[model samples]
Target: MPRFSANLGFLWKDIALPDAIRAAKRAGFEAVECHWPYDFSTDSVNQALNDTGLPMVGINTRLGINGIDDLGVCAMPGREAEAKGYIDEAIAYAVAIGCRNINAVAGKTGSTDEAEAVYRRNLAYACAEAAKHDKTIVIEPLSHRAAPGYHLSNVEKGLETIKAVGVANLKLMFDVFHVQVMQGDLIERLRATLPHIGHIQIAAVPDRGEPDQGEVNYPDLLAALDDMGWDGYVGAEYHPRGTMEQGLGWLKAYQ
Candidate 1:
């Protein structure tokens, strides 16, 4: 059976960071990941992880004043320095917490040529930083409609960027929800692009809710992963339209 983990950044938005960790433990998750532990101190986050004995699967870099809901690092022009700083912080945090993956958002959209150049340069730098700590940096592609003009909003484009960078530590963060929205053929695409995939995130299509609430048949998806021998974690990166506990039922059933 596939191991289960939760993205507390989305699931427990209403509670404190430490409380979110507690809730994930209560929900029977063996591991957890988060966008940014903004609400809690590093010591507090460390304490929760230590107490729960739940490994942190991943953690996102800080977005600074833009915050996670607005936009983040990859969008700003001439912010390569700032972006590097953010990535460095995440690398340090991941090393401290024993995390293996770090998800890097490409911010908002930029001009095609400009975005491409910036993304490649920034990711190359970020990948080098992550490699120092033996962690992988996965670049996520949001749906085009959701992030218009953004470079890296589709798997094809993301793969191109990764190839351009040619950094071994850099790979794609394949989120099923975004891919289902922007590009169809999840399984085939996953197989074709398996070499570039470093991490995976799952959510129901349309609703971005529980896996069972939408059109995705996760059993088959998991089976595909098994066939491919995917070694990374399948991050539960979804929002619960209802209660958090209700959302966990699908994962429980999946296991």
Candidate 2:
């Protein structure tokens, strides 16, 4: 069976982040992931994970003051220094919390070519920094519809950027929801790109709701992952339909 990690970023929106870690544990999740953990005191969150025995699978790089389009400053020209600072902070936190994956976003802008160049340089630097902590760095492709002007908006671009960086620790954060929205053929694409993927995230397509409510057939999707011999975590990254408890029905089989 595939192991599922609750994405506390969306799963427990109703509680404090420290409390959310407990909630995910009580709800039967063995692991967790968050968009960013910098807002809360790192010590408190680390203690919670220790108490609950839930490994935090991943967290994202910080994107301060920049627009929603500017999530990953690393890819934005003129912000290389700012990006490195965020990377340094993220690496320190990941080491402190015992987490190993960091998702770096590529912010969108006017010139795709320039942004790609900047993204390549920044990702290469990030890969080197992450390797120091034995951490894996991932670049995710956001849906253009959800995030207009985002530079890394599709798997093709994401792959090209990864190649450009040419770092062993650098890989793609294969998000099913975004990929489904941007391009279909999840199985084919997943199979073709499985080796390049470092982590996976899922939710409903068209709507960011629970996997059960979306068009995605998660059972089949997960089964495919199982057959592919994927050993990484499958993050449940979705908004609840009602209470988070109600949204948990789909997870019983996997659990």
Candidate 3:
């Protein structure tokens, strides 16, 4: 069976970061990831992970100028400095917590060559800095429906950017939810992008709720991951339909 990682960003949003990590452990998850755990000290987070022996899989960079309203600024023109600052901060935090992947948010921008150029340049820098610490930089493609104007809005764009960056440490965050919304060929896409993928996330499409409530068949999808020899953890990144525990029945299949 494939290992599963609890995404504290959604799974335990009401609790403290350290407690969330502990919660994930008690729930039988092998690992944990988060959207933003910056509010908590790395020491606290480290302590929880140490106590539970659950690996911190990955974390996302800070949002852009608009904060909650903006997803990121890495691909936004003229915000290169801001983007790098977020990248540096994320890397430092990830290192302190022994986290493996740093997600470089692409932010919102027009589908222009300049935006792509800026994104590529920033990714190159991020990859170089992260590689120094033996950390990987992963970028995800947000669906146009969920994040309108987001620069990296498709897997093809994300893959192309990784290739253009030409760095081994840079890879794609294959988020199943967004990919299903933007494109439907999940297995084929996974086959094509598997080698370049650093992490995988899953949630229900359309509603973004519990995995079992989605249009996609997660059991088959996860089985496909196993057949493909993927050794990485699949992040359970989704909001609970009710309480976190009440919606976790879907996890039993993998356990």
Candidate 4:
């Protein structure tokens, strides 16, 4: 069976981190991922993971002051040094917490080609840092509406940027929600970019809710992944439109 990991960052926002772990465990998840365990200490995170015996499948870099609201790493100009620091910190945290994947945000939009080139250079530097710790940096392509003038808004563009970086540690994170919103033909895209895909995230297409509640037929998607022989985790990275437990009914049916 394909492993299912809950994204605590979105699911259990109201509960404490430890409680979130217990909740996920009770909900029948084998692993969990989060945006950043900012409010909790590394020891706290480790304790929860150890207690539940759930692998920390993935993590994100610090989003600066605003957290998830202002999720951009490559958007800012001349802040490559700052971005590198964040990536380094995330890498250290992931290593300390036994995580193998780290999601990197391609900040906001840039002006000229020269500016975009700088962003790519920064990504390469960050990827090199992550590679040192055996952690892969998955670049997420957000919808153009969410990230205006964003450098990597689609799978093709994201793959192109990864190629430009030319770093082995850099790979693509195919978020089905964002991809569905930004571009259609999900299965075909996944098949075409199978070689470059390093991580996957999913949610309902229009609402970012449960998989069963959305337009995407997840069983078909999962079957496709199985056919492709994908070995990575598919993170549940969506906001629950109702009670978290109610939203997770789809997972129960997976088995």
Candidate 5:
């Protein structure tokens, strides 16, 4: 079975982040990832991880003023300074907390050449800075339906950006939920992108809730990863239908 990581961003939204880390451990998760934990002190988060013996796997850069709609400023033209600042802050925090991966949010843009250029330049900077700390930077492609103008809205663009950056540590975050919504060919896509996949995440289709009721067969997907000899955490980044425990019936099989 594939190792699982609790995405504390969605799995335990009611409690403090440090407590959520402990909850993930109590719930039998091997590791944990978060959307944003900047509000909490690094010392506290690190203490929780050390206490639980669970590695904090990933965390996103600041979303800035536009929040989810802006996603991130890294790819937004005329916001290079702000984007780099977010990347710098994320890298510093990741190093402090022993997290290896940072999701550098590529803010929404009009798919213009200028925007693409800006994204590549900023990503190159992020990759270089992250390299100093032995960190990997990942870019996620949001579903066009859910995030219409996001810069990295499809796999092709994600791959292209990585290629343009031309760095070893820059990789793609293969979020199955969004990939399924944007492109139906998961297996082939995974195969093609496996070399550059830095992390994987899962959620139900359409609803973005528990994976058990989704159109995608998560067991088969996990099996596919196993078959490919891909040993990495499949992040459970889904919103619970009820309490987190109530929606975790599907996790028993995986665990």
Candidate 6:
């Protein structure tokens, strides 16, 4: 069976981060991941994981200040320092939490050419620094509908950035929801990008809801992952249709 990591950022949103970890544990999740757990003390989150014996599969880098909607500034011009610092912070947090993956989002930019240039350079630096700690750095493609001003809106752009970075630690964070929105050939794209993929996330298409609530057949997709030797966590990242527990039937079906 495929290993599914509950994305605590979306799940258990009404509770504290530590309590969410516990909730995931009690819900039968062997591993978990989060968006930004920095609001609370790092030690508190770490203790929750320790108590539950649940591994944090991954965590994302700081998106940016409010109002700007900067999901990640790595691709923005003149924000290289901020981007690097955020990666440092994420790496420290990942180290403290015993997680090995950190996904970075590319912020909006005024210039696409410059953004790609800056993004590649910043990604190379992040990969180098993260590699020192034996950690993986992932860049995900968000759909324009989901993130209107985001820089990398498709897998091709993400892959181009990865190639330009020319580093082994840098990889793609493949999200099924976003990919399905931008492109429809999930299986072919997955196979072609398998070499550059570091981690994966999933949610229902069209509505950004649970996998079972969407048009995608997750059972076959997950089975494809196993057959293709994708030894990474398929992060359950989606908003609950009604309750978080109700959305887990898809995972249970696979198991």
Give the TM-scores of the predictions, in the order they appear.
0.92, 0.96, 0.97, 0.93, 0.98, 0.96
Query: For residues 10-48, what per-residue lDDT tens digits would candidate 1 score against the true structure?
Result: 888798877888888888887888988755677888899
**Native-vs-model 5 lDDT?**
0.91
For candidate 6, write residues 109-186 as lDDT tens digits: 743898888888888888888888999999988888888878887898788888877889989999999999988789
Hey, what RMSD does candidate 3 come out at?
Answer: 1.0
TM-score of 2: 0.96
lDDT of 3 by residue, 1-255 (tens): 779999998888998999999999989999999999999999999999999999999999999779856689888889999999999999999999999999998877776899889989998889899998999999999888988888887899888888888989999999999999999899889988999999999999879998886689888888888899999999999878898879888887556
How many residue pairs clash (N, CA or C atoms closer than 3 angstroms) in each of the candidate models, in the order given? 2, 1, 1, 4, 0, 0
Q: How far does residue 101 in candidate 6 sit from its true spot (Å)?
A: 0.9
Residue pairs with clashing backbones, model 1: 109-149, 109-150
Clashing pairs in 3: 72-107
Where model 4 places Cα greater than 4 Å from the true spot, the runs are 65-70, 110-112
The TM-score of candidate 4 is: 0.93
User: What's the true lDDT of residue 98 in model 3?
Assistant: 94
| Alpha-carbon shift of residue 133 in model 2 (angstroms) | 1.0
Model 1 TM-score, all chains together: 0.92
Among all windows of 10 consecutive residues in model 4, the one with the lowest summed lDDT is: 66-75
Model 2 misplaced stretches (Cα beyond 4 Å):
67-69
lDDT of each: 0.80, 0.86, 0.90, 0.81, 0.91, 0.86
**Which run of 10 residues does model 5 get worst, by summed lDDT?**
246-255
Best by TM-score: 5
Among the numbered candidates, top lDDT falls to: 5
Model 5 Cα lDDT, one tens digit per residue, 107-161: 7887789999999999999999999999999999999887888888788889999
- Using TM-score as the measure, name the better of candidate 2 and candidate 3: 3
Q: Candidate 3, which segments miss by more than 4 Å at Cα?
A: none
